[model samples]
Target: MKILIVGTGGVGGYFGGRLAQAGHEVTFIARGKHREAIEKHGLDVKSINGNFSVTNISVTDKISDVPRPDLIIVSVKAWQVKDIAQQLKPVIGKETMVLPLQNGVLASDELKEFLPQQNVLSGLCRIISKIDGPGKINHLAVDPTIVFGECDNSKTDRVYALEKVFNDSGFKGRVAKDIQSDIWKKFISICVSAWLAVTRSTYGEVREQPETRKVMRDLFEEVTELAYKKGVNIEPDFVDKTMAFIDTFPPESTSSLTRDVWEGKPSELEYQNGSVVKLADEIGLDVPINRFIYYSLILMEEKAKKK
Candidate 1:
């Protein structure tokens, strides 16, 4: 399949590099030294499974330069997904599919608002990797996996084709029966974890204080409640399962949002805690814990944006 990887950061670069290694025609959309480095040397991925290089990578900041692709994998920050969705219009073909792997539940909706609903697929990526250099990506922990399906949850031919694509490329690719619910599951986890990271500092620190942990649990509960209210049927005990999952994270581990806040880099707060607050309001519910996180992250995001 001809693939265009927008925002070639760690997650994009790692998976894109693997696809290229598997000998699929791949193009990368990136900027500055990253794009230059990929065009000149190659996109490099260092992984525990294997290391490979895409020296002949097709890369350009301008989408018009590349051919219309069959699949477009959007790996940009959650806040940037809408803009990227708008930019995709020119390059989208009649049968093209846009899969957004942003770490939030609203990405498909954002894409649908710009592109035709048929062009946007319900999807999310499960990968712990990031760019280490201009054209280098480091795969840190999790085995890269992509979960995607039709928005309506139908087992269509296209969804089956995508599953085969990932399977052929030798990585995890799942076609979810309830893609919306699956997306919500991922969203709730991010909401809780990002809240903890933004407020308490680290996963370990969030676990250290009983009061902070309680707030973290409450955050999960609120998000889960919001999900159910909106018709996303997550498991009844999802909150407890998520809390147990959070406890398994290494103590020193901090969420990427927390790292961004600490380093004063741009973050996805607007779609995370902020989205929770917005959704809560839309649903006519109260999510005080998420509201607090949303406001706090907004302040940090503002300073980061200014710098």
Candidate 2:
């Protein structure tokens, strides 16, 4: 399969490297020193399962330079999806599939606003990985998995074909029965954990402390309530399930949002917590905790953008 990976950061670098290693035609859209390094010396992936390198692959900074691909995996931050979707217009063939593996639930929706609805697929990925260096990717934890499906949850041959591609590349893949609920499941857990971690507390600290833990629960409930109001059929006991999921995290674990905020870089505060607040306000729902989180970090977010 011919694949184009946009935003070759942690998620894109690792998965694209795997696909390239499997002998699929994979091209990466990257920028700055990362693009230069990948061009000079192939992309390297250091993983717990195994290590591999994707040498002699195409790497470009412009989407216009690449050929039309069978699939385009968008792995950029949530806030960048709209711009990337607009930039992808020239390459989206009639049968081309665009899958978004961003951190939040709004990526596919954002893509649909700019691209054809039939060409967009809702997707989410589970992996703890990052760009270790300019040309290298590090798979730090979790068995990498991708869950995706059609927008309306209908079974399609194209969806299964993509699943085959993922299975052949040596990672876990599943076609979601309910892609929206699956996306929300991930959103609820990540949204709560990320903001809590931003309070300068590790997973251990957040879960162990009574006050912080209570805040975490409130955040989860607020998000889940928003999901219900939006008509997503999430599990009733999802809050308890999310707590159980957090319990499995390593004590010192922190989210990508936490890391970005700590480094004073532009983060996904808008798409995560800010999205919840925006959606809730549209429906006249009061998401006080989420509103608080968004307002608290928005100034810092604006400052990072200035930098």
Candidate 3:
């Protein structure tokens, strides 16, 4: 399949590298030094699975340069959705399916608003990887699952074909019967984890400290309740399961928000934590922990800027 990856960050760079290495015709859309490095050397993926280097992949900064690919993977950060969706007009054709592996729940809707003619699929990627440097991605976990489906929940031939390509490439891909639920479940885990980690505390610290653990658990419950109010049938024991999962991760393991804190970079706090808080208020619900987290991260961002 001819695929175009819109954002060449860790998610895009790693998975797109995997597809390209498997001999699929993949084109990456990136800019700045990262794009330059990929065009000159190649996309590099450093993982426990083994290092992969693919030099034949095509890459460009301009969206106009991208052909009408059969599939497009929108892997950019959640905050870039609006502009990126608008910029995708020229390269997205009617038959093309755009799979967005973004955080939160509004990406597909935003994309559809921009490119109504194209098919926008809702997808969630479970991969612990990040752009370690320009043109370099660090894969930090064993899970490489992608759960997605069509907007209307119909089983289409195109969905099956895409699933085949994903599986054939050696990555775990499932066509979820309820992709919306999948997206919400991911958001629940992500919001809780990101909120806790944004405190500049390690996972071990958050898990071990009774007060911190309680706060984290409360936050998780709030998100789950809000998700239910929003019509997503998330698992009842989602919090317990997610907490147990986090306990097994490395003590030093942190989320993208925590990574941003450490590196003095901007975070998607508004889209992640801020989204939940805003929705809770609209629905006449109170989520104090989430609200606290959203504003706390804002203060951190401010401090970083002043420094």
Candidate 4:
């Protein structure tokens, strides 16, 4: 299969490298120093699963040079999805399947704005990965799971085939019965953690303060309720289930947003908490907690950009 992986960050780089290791034809889209490093030295993945390198890679920043891919896996930050999707219009073929592995729930809808809905899959990845250096991906934690399915929750052959592709690459990939809800399940946790972590700079403080933990759990409840209101078939126990999951985050762990903020980088603040607040406003639902976090982070991000 000819696969195109956009934004060779932790999720894309690690998974794309695994696919290349499985002997599949993969093209990577990256820019700047990262692209230069890969062009010269190949992509390196340091995984707790196992470390490996893929050299002689097909990588370029130009979309015009890319072949019409059988699959396009988008791993950019949630905020970059729209522009990337528009840029992908040239390479998207009638048979191409686009999988969005970013955090937050807006990715598929954002892709749908530029590509056919049939071509977009509702997906999210479970992994802790990041660029340790130029052309280098570090998988710090998680078993590297990818849960995806058709946008309408159909059991299509394409989903099964993609699941096979993921499994063949030695990652835990599966089709979700309800992909939107699965996405919301991921959203509930990531939204809470990203906001609290971004605001407080560490989970250690929140983990210590009973009141902060309460606020954190409330944020999860807001998103879960919002998902239910939006007609996603989330589990009834989503809040409790998600809160338990949050307890397991490693002591030093922070959301990707927090990491990006610390590095003075642009983040998905708009797509994560910001999206939740925007949606709630449209539906006449109140999301004060999400609203507060979203606006607060926007200020922080602006300050970071000026530095």
Best by TM-score: 2
In terms of TM-score, how similar is model 1 to the real structure? 0.93
lDDT of 2 by residue, 127-168 (tens): 878888899998877789999999999999999999999989
lDDT of 3 by residue, 40-111 (tens): 999988986788899967999987787688899999888788899888887777788899999888889889
Which sections of candidate 2 miss by over 4 Å? none
lDDT of each: 0.85, 0.90, 0.84, 0.86
lDDT of candidate 4 over 1-307, digit per residue (tens): 9999998988899999999989999999999999999999999999889999999999999866775899999998887889999899988899999999988887888899989888899899999888989999999777899999999899999999999999999898999998887888888888865555455556656766788788888898898889889998887887888777666666666767888866777787777888899999989999888888887778877876677
**lDDT for 201 (candidate 4):** 50
TM-score of 4: 0.94
Task: Sort every candidate by lDDT, greatest first.
Answer: 2, 4, 1, 3
Ranking by TM-score, best first? 2, 3, 4, 1
Q: Please provide, for model 1 over 8-65, each residue's C-alpha lDDT reduced to its tens digit, 9 standing for 90 to 100.
A: 9987898888888889999999999999999999988888778888788799998777
lDDT preference between candidates 3 and 4, better one: 4
Collision pairs in model 1: 10-130
Q: Which stretches of candidate 4 lie over 4 Å from their true place?
A: 303-307
